[model samples]
Target: MTRYILTTCLCLFAALAQAQMRWNQAYQQYINQYKDLAIEQMLKYNIPASITLAQGLFESRAGLSVLATKGNNHFGIKCHGWQGRAVYHDDDARNECFRAYRNAYESYEDHSRFLAGGQRYRKLFSLKVTDYKGWAHGLRAAGYATNPQYAKKLIEIIQLYKLHEFDKARKYDKFFARRSKDIAGKGGVLHQVFEFNNNYYVKARRGDTFRTIAAEVGISYRSLAKYNERNRKDILEEGEIIYLKKKRTKAPKSYKGRLHYVKPGESMYSIAQLYGIRLANLYKMNGLSPDYQIRVGDGLRLR
Candidate 1:
């Protein structure tokens, strides 16, 4: 009897492991297929790509949910005000009205518009594009979900899959490349080198890109990105500052212990650039974890 029980337990464990592996593989495949679309929607609507993808993955069950498979409703957005075709799905209540789409891309686009156009969600747009945590919490605060753990669940999904990497301001993702040609494709290239806190940087001009900047500066692409403390996924944008070398560990010795108040259009990365301080060191000096979203009135240490 003991030997039989052991065999049964082993069989059950193996079956569970195989099911878990299959779910992960399916989720990964879903991400790979829709990541570009998520990034594009982000650029168009100013929503965080990570938040969009995470919401889609969770609501749609990696595109395997009945709503996704049958109605192409990847976001589970209800039809409270939607005028499009509809599908009934069992959610908080049975036969809840959800918007149906012609295709997956249509569903993604509607998801962006649904949030962007909602009066309740207006405040979320004020957050930096990379502030996925803020968006997650704000979505719950704005009644996007009744689930008490909605924000926590979204954060977990983001960290578990490293989905936050998709929240780039801009980059060479195929979507971005096609969107930004050479420079921004709007005007002539013009930049002036400047110095701050003993670090050198240049303002990215119209139509200027990392490739063009690298060629003009006579530095390799990798070296220039490394110098600017940017990862491979970061993209340069017009009129943005591009550091010529790695930033310092802190603000100038003279500016130590100073407090800088956050303002609109400011982010942790932008603040780090403003003071010519290393992003990681700045976070450390402020006792902020990477997931801490800086608010407009928040004060940050400049040491």
Candidate 2:
């Protein structure tokens, strides 16, 4: 009798696990259908497509939740400033006020813009899409959800579903040339040279790890490690100034204004001259674009 009981428990457990796996598989299918829309929104808003998709999947339970069925709110975004339509649904317990969208696309667009327009998320925009870890942490810091493990859950979903690849930029012109016709038109190409103090520093985004910045800028990680006064394994802080070459660095000058998009074959020297600003001033205001080799469509601060 004991053996039979144990066998029955094992079977039940296996069945439950299988059911859970099926649910996850179904959720992935839902995400796959909307992957392109997510990527498009990410490109326009700088939010990682993975985060957007994960939030949608989790909150809507792969579109099986009542909120999604009735209201089309995949992320459970509240009606804090909502002026459109509102719906109440049982979430934590009592019915909660949620924003209602006309369709799923509207929800995605609102979520992306919500993060982008918020001042708290402004710092996160400086990060690259691949730096989902930082963005995950940032979201938590910005109070996206109440759960303590929110970032971990989102990261797990992204990895399990291979959503991070959406952020990968097409560096090869030929590859992007074909992609441009299918996707968004050809990506802009602009090269920038970031010159700082006596030495030059590579322009870096928030998502750039010290190791990645070092590798891209052709400096030893150890050298960068020593210069930044950080441990070799330490993640880099956004806007933490460091020199590409080993030398004493000076405080960068700050320019107040909006960033201008760099065009193809544009140099920092020419950009500065065109804006009627000193090259050094322009370099200090911006970090990564001064390197003289900038990609087209990259934003440069003009003010």
Candidate 3:
């Protein structure tokens, strides 16, 4: 009898574990489906993608709620003077009216405008787009939801999914993804990223262009150009080092007190690129003017 009971308990535990796994998969699928919309809304409306996603996930139960599935309401936004199609759902009261949309995109867009246009959320706008915590707490304080734990719930969701990455879509640049070989789906091109001077960079392979590198590394094309101090349309050589970050003014400490001897076929720009230092700073360090001529065998201080 004891053995039979233990077996039954083990079976029930296995079922419960599988149910949890399914729920996690559902949440991840929900994020995958709506992440782009959330990011788009953030860029257009100056809202944090993390906050938008958390709200959608929580309010819509990962887009599985009746309002979301049937009425296309991912945010649980109620019809407070909403001049559009509507759905009624139980909330603070029975069958409370909620705004409905033709599609999830429309719902996401409306959620952005709703927050952007509301006076109560004006203070949220003042917070940095990367400050998901502030936005989460502020939403509750501004009465965006009646639940006292709304902010906590949103924060938990954001952390669980690492959704804050989308908040600083441009600046953080995938949190400067350390030696991230995981750029497989970002672009088909394969290039090894390296870390130096507390920054990241990648080498330009044969046939690599700024656009291609940017696409592969999940960086903006223009940003990669600026980092490399090159024009957007400039061609990348087979072995050129393209810094993902703005090159430092001086070489790293390890190269201190060392001097770079101008080698044949090398220019000031090439030397700076080699050391991952700013060209302007390199010139400044060696007391060389902007148009100073560098000849072969001339010693230039790297630091």
Which candidate achieves the best lDDT against the true structure?
Answer: 3
Per-residue alpha-carbon lDDT of model 2 for 1-303, expressed as tens digits? 999999999999999856644436557656645666677777777778788878888878776677677777778888888899888977666888899876666777788888888887899999988898889889988888889988887877778777788767333122212221232111111112344444545444577677876654455888876654457787655654555555432223454456768888776655654444555666776765445577789788765
Which portions of model 3 miss their true places by more than 4 Å?
1-23, 171-303
lDDT of each: 0.78, 0.66, 0.81
Instruction: Indicate the residue-level lDDT of 263 in model 2.
Output: 87
TM-score for candidate 1: 0.51
Residue-wise C-alpha lDDT for candidate 1, range 205-243, written one tens digit per residue = 776667777765545778877767787446667778887
Query: What shift in Å separates residue 129 of candidate 1 from its native position after superposition?
Result: 1.0
Report the C-alpha displacement of residue 261, candidate 2, in angstroms.
56
Worst 10 residues of 3 by lDDT: 179-188
How much lDDT does candidate 3 score?
0.81
Stretches > 4 Å off in candidate 1: 1-23, 169-303
Q: Evaluate residue 27 in candidate 3 and report its C-alpha lDDT on the 0 to 100 scale.
A: 73
lDDT of 3 by residue, 1-303 (tens): 999999999999999856643337667767765666677678889999999988999998887788887777889999999899898988899999998876666778788999999999999999999999999999999999999988988988898789999887753333322212223222112455566776777778998999998876668999999998999999999889999878998888988888889989999999998888899999999998999999999999988
